[model samples]
Target: MTLDLDPLRSGLHHRHDRVLIAAVAGGDTAHRTYGAPEAADAEIGSVSKGLTGLLYQDAVDRGEVTPETTLGEALDRPEGAYAQATLGSLATHASGLPPQPPYGGPRTMLRRTWRMWRHGENPYGDSVDQLLDEAADVRLGKPRFVYSNLGFALLGAALARTAGTSYERLLLARVAEPLGMTGVSVPSTPRCLGPTALTGRSKGGRPHEPWTGEAIGPAGGVRATAADLAALLGGLIERRAPGISALDPAADAPGASRIGAAWLTTRTGDASVTWHNGRTGGFASWVGVDRDAGVGLALVSATAASLDRDGFAGLARLRAEADRC
Candidate 1:
């Protein structure tokens, strides 16, 4: 069941796709469509959360923070009602924040968007700041996995304030530079294409304006190369990426069979390896390693989907084969 991935690369790139791979185990690095001499780059969508997670980890390493930290304790008041969450909650999608712009219509998109800008482009697209303006009222009543972009946005804001600097600077100073992840940043253009729908194909306006407006910047605003991700993955195995094993979850964090901090720990069934996969608009990617075998893999693609049974199987086989190296 070992997969070579060369044909996969050819199939993707030949179909006008862009692909990149860094086999940490074999020291094999290839950029099929975009390289230093070529022309293409990976468009990481929610994958950016991993980068944000890494920043938070660096904050922890500096003893400036902890996963148990509450947003209220981190940020000063006057922002107002949404606190009670933590870095772990935001990174793990358990912060109970909304998925997209709270409300919108295609007809109203432009007008409301302008309004959002006028409102300071808050990621919540509402008076979420006002909600958390006071620490006394904000509640940690209950917690659930809401896949919160808003929480990450707030966490990034918190990180910036704690470091006494901007979020972008925090990223470079604490993350990108340390990991040698050059050229990873917010994309100049939108992350994905407009979906084909009307009703409007989805709710909370997700599959629309993901990066539009200003507030959700911290949630999914990042792009990086497979090579850089591979190096970062190496840090996981070497335990240098923030000096914590990306494979190990914190005591209070829920146990996950797949990943810790934007990484997948194990693939089940016929696949007996570990990896982390990502899907962005017009792009799909995965990176993982056979922890037991000391072999690693990184992959990138242009097609995005959720239930890619075949894609996952293909990646497992590819990684398993590479794991032999």
Candidate 2:
């Protein structure tokens, strides 16, 4: 099924910007976009962590690792920063970590993460040394929702270690390739960003970076086309409510709560959906699927919201359309 989504068409219609919507359900795929580009690909951001969590689960289903795997042991680091954290804790965002790094620039973010792992505040740091230091010095409360990028980043590292390969390799071999998502990548495939706020032709803006490659691979670096993301939604939705649950802050923490990985899980009547949206400087995208109702949806926009919930609203509308379909 393609999509019965004309009502939810580009709420923001303009020149030089766009939105794409794709859906799969009852054995069909359909997609549409505004400002569509032949090479329109952008990062899924923290949604990458959720995909990493799903990959970790896939590993468990394949008997590669158990949910009980200690963070340190899982990554083969006995005294690492996140050593005391467990796989479940990381997956659930109960590991005490700050939301974003102390800094904003990607390079600065990496440096600050290392510092927190070493000497600064331990909350948002992402380096091995900084994490080890923080892990030794700080202890998170049991089962409390901490919503942390550091937590998910550690989980990504653990996944790489479990797969005995790079995070990029694991993402490609286990996810993108298997699903025929050549347009999807944890490490971007020929990544580049245009000069615009969500794809506008704004002048004087800098050309954006390609998400930090392997550096942010697990956290927020997966780039994908709208159609490719719809395929991923298809897979996740098709496999929903099974022995697997994607790491979603909205799902793990409900009621418009602030949580890590910034994903949302909403249940409508008998149907439950897990979803997320992504943005770089110039593009935005959303992808989601319902486990029980067999519905999936994808949306991408060149122009984005300063707030990210627009994507969620789009998906909600998609679900609403499905009610009629």
Candidate 3:
């Protein structure tokens, strides 16, 4: 039942300067990191949203919240159209929220560009209170398949507020700790960066600042080692992970026909792969599983590039190999 990941790793190395690949097929597991330690931390970008989805489901299971729970109820906000959207809608990107709070106007765009080009700073960093303030006075679009970072940020805040804890602690208690993902974390600031944290780079090889902030943590601030993330994939595949129900499809998405919480399920060859990918200023990651086949793969890179196809290919290969076994 042992899996061969060399072919997949070789292909990934061709596309990325630094890459990490981990796989589990038929109860066998393997992981390899190139130009980085297997234990080094890397930004997981919007993959954090997938984790948030898990938190939402776990809250549902605990009777603290339900899919019908509105943002206004969880966040204690005043009645408004924007706050009327349910947590389920937010989890599935059908909440009609924008990708993020609007930072319109020429001056704001210029400042954001300056920070990114000059200092590699993340412009999305905001505190929970700040994000909540932005949610106020915002307009909602028709509920559809718009991917939203703001919706997730607000969802995380709502979940935390309902539990009477910070999102960081809630994530730890409800997901990371239970799953033994010690390397996974949502850092509030750059000062909390781990010593083993890997520095990511832009496509042009320019180093970028780590994406961190309490407000954005649920949306894109998660970081983890390859080993830890791979373990997470394994937990999900085994259905032992808390919030495992998050993988069940609840809406439609682009590319993937069905969306579950934050995971996307798409048919690749004969297998239905449930997966999520992430990207930050400099880092990219992809995690996928064919639950029926009990095979999973997680790939991370320090370079900012798409890894979706590579991840899907890797998982397929693992499933194929498992079939032979």
Q: Please, what is the whole-model Cα lDDT of each candidate in the order they appear?
A: 0.52, 0.58, 0.85
* Cα lDDT tens digits for candidate 1, 237-294: 4556663543454333334454455444554664545544555334555655555545
Q: Write the per-residue lDDT of candidate 2 for residues 1-325, one digit (tens) a residue.
A: 3465565564544522456667765666766555556446655666676677777777777887776888778867776545777777777777665554333445455774464334422223134334334444344556667666667766777778777887778887887776667777554233333332133211123334344444456776666676667667766766642124443342247554433233467654555666665554444556666655666777665443322455556556666666666
- Model 2 segments beyond 4 Å from truth? 1-7, 13-16, 101-142, 188-207, 240-244, 247-252, 256-264, 268-271, 280-282, 304-309, 323-325
For each of the candidates, the C-alpha root-mean-square deviation to the true structure, in angstroms, is 7.2, 6.2, 1.9
In angstroms, how far off is 155's CA in candidate 1?
A: 2.0
Q: Is candidate 2 or candidate 3 better by TM-score?
A: 3
**How far off is model 2, as Cα RMSD?**
6.2
Task: Kindly indicate the candidate among 1 and 3 with the higher TM-score.
Answer: 3
Question: TM-score per candidate, in order?
Answer: 0.69, 0.74, 0.95
* TM-score of candidate 1 to 2 decimals: 0.69
How big is the positional error of residue 55 in model 2, measured in Å on the Cα after superposition? 0.5
Candidate 1 Cα errors over 4 Å, as ranges: 1-5, 10-16, 27-31, 34-39, 101-141, 187-215, 250-259, 270-276, 305-311, 322-325
Alpha carbon lDDT at 182, candidate 2: 71
